[model samples]
Target: MTCSPDDFRAAMRRFPSGVAIVAAGSAPHRAGMTATAICSLSADPPQVLACLNRLSSTCRAVEDARFFSINLLATSQLALARIFAGLEGGVSADQKFTAGVWRLGVTGAPILEDAVLTFECALVTAHPASTHNIVIGEVRHITGEVAEDALIYRSGVFGRWTGLAVTQPHLS
Candidate 1:
């Protein structure tokens, strides 16, 4: 039997994911959206993948410009994430940058200055599946800080890394 959308979504939500923003284009035509489907693909050529909804303006911009940036959010940036996700009504397409400091990357995509990590990539390819496009890109530039904590999402709730870890016992 085919899985129902609600069931699929519920199951997927159990897996905690780091929050990020996929942004494209420059001022006046810039578009961005909160995303969680980003991951490293390869290190040889420094590649990564970010999935964007096909109908999102950011996705269309990336397609046309052939580039994009994945800005990984820190735990303190939940408000920014919400704003970029369009959850905050009345914020227009171009005004999203007003919520945070942004700069143009080497590929001309908007990059969040305060992101825990930023990956500026040149679009390599995109594969369409259902309502989203799996956009693959080759990393051209990156900047990050290791001390920053990350924002996480799971089961419709937002959380953060508390920097807690258990010490491992010695093993032979």
Candidate 2:
């Protein structure tokens, strides 16, 4: 038997992904949102893909900002992650970053200073992907923790650092 739509979604959610809040903006119009669907689409050209809802405010910001940043949240950044995730509803794009610890990337997108990693990128391509659009970005700048662990989402909750264990054998 084929999996129902809900079953497919449930199964997909079981696979944990590194949490990241992708930011894009131009000063007062900046916007960001938490995303767990970003992934490497190509290694040769240093490209990655992010999926964002077409109607999301952040999605609109990305369209006009010319650049985007992926801030890989550390395990300790759960609060920041939640804030950007829109779990508490939307806030003015500028206001959202006011309380968070962030610094500007080369592309001018806000990069969380405490993030495990951050990638500043320029849009390369975009295509329709189900209810969202798959944005492919060309990595332009890279910074942040080379050794820090990443926060993860699993079973609709966050509290894991799988990257820490995988990267540091000493911790394993």
Candidate 3:
């Protein structure tokens, strides 16, 4: 049960996760970040949870905005994800938004129009998790593109989901 950080990374590499960008636009300091630490938190009211680093520029955007949107990237969107994730400081946050195409979600967060699936939500709750904040959001609107394959993250790199049948029968 007790694993070092290296062990934690190794364990996580086994569970491939869908790649997404969480974005908000309450200020000129719009927030967007590549994320794989996303999960469903509720069903009845439709909620989602995303874990965020406290010092990330994306965190500041969420802290100031009432709502945010999740952009599920397709394989082609990998470049976009990297751009947002690569921005290293406060001065570059706004410029990152300019690199992608977006539309205002119900709460004004920018939803990447080319995303395979998108979610807009109202902030509902947050809890501290050691070094990251687990923020929950109540879903307000969602859109999807069934034909596009999803992007995935595993083994410290980005890849696209093939959507092939699981003939291997392995849990992962």
Candidate 4:
């Protein structure tokens, strides 16, 4: 038997994931949405994958622009995240930029000036997967250093990764 949607969501909630805002386009026409479905797809070619809902305006912008930036949020950016997520009702597409400092990336996508990390990428391909588009992008630019105070989402709650134990295991 297949798991129900609610069951699937419940299971996925147990997996903690980093929070980020995926943005595209230039000023006056930019689009952005809070996302947790971004990850590095490859290192050699420097690629990343971000899943966007097929119906989101940002998804269309990314498709039309063929470029986007993934801005990883810090714990301090919870309000920004909520704004992009449309949780701050009545905030229009253009108004969301007013909430954060933004700059144009090499790919022309809007980058968060104070993001924990930002990845500017050129669209490689987008595959339609059920209700979302699996967007693949080739890294064109990167900014920010790795920091411990990154934002995370799990179990329907937004939180931060507390520095537990930093360790590197040797592979023999």
Off by over 4 Å in 2: 89-92, 162-172
| Candidate closest to the true structure, highest lDDT | 4
Global local distance difference test of model 3: 0.83
lDDT by candidate, in order shown: 0.90, 0.84, 0.83, 0.93
Report the lDDT tens digits of candidate 1 across residue range 1-172: 9999999899999998999999998889999999989899999999999888999999998998888999999988999999998899999687998998999987788999889999999999999989999999999999887467889988888898665488887699
Sort all candidates by TM-score, best to worst.
4, 1, 3, 2
Cα lDDT of model 4 by residue, 54-74, tens digit? 999999999999999999999
Per-residue accuracy of model 2 over 1-172 as CA lDDT, tens digit each: 8889999889988898999998998667788999999999888899999999988888888878879999888887888888887666765567789757777787888787777888999988778877898988999988885465788898898977543334554553
Q: TM-score of the candidate numbered 3? A: 0.88
| Model 1: residues with Cα > 4 Å off, grouped in runs | 169-172
- Segments of candidate 3 deviating more than 4 angstroms: 87-91, 164-172
Pick by lDDT: 1 or 3, better one: 1
Q: Candidate 3 vs candidate 4: which has greater TM-score? A: 4
Q: What is the lDDT of residue 99 in candidate 2?
A: 56
Error of 2 at 129 (Å): 1.7
Per-residue lDDT for 5 in model 3? 97
What order do candidates take by lDDT, descending? 4, 1, 2, 3
TM-scores across all candidates?
A: 0.93, 0.88, 0.88, 0.94
Pairs that clash in candidate 4? none
Alpha-carbon runs more than 4 Å astray in model 4: 146-148, 165-172
**Position 65, candidate 2: lDDT:** 80
How high is the lDDT of residue 161 in model 2?
57
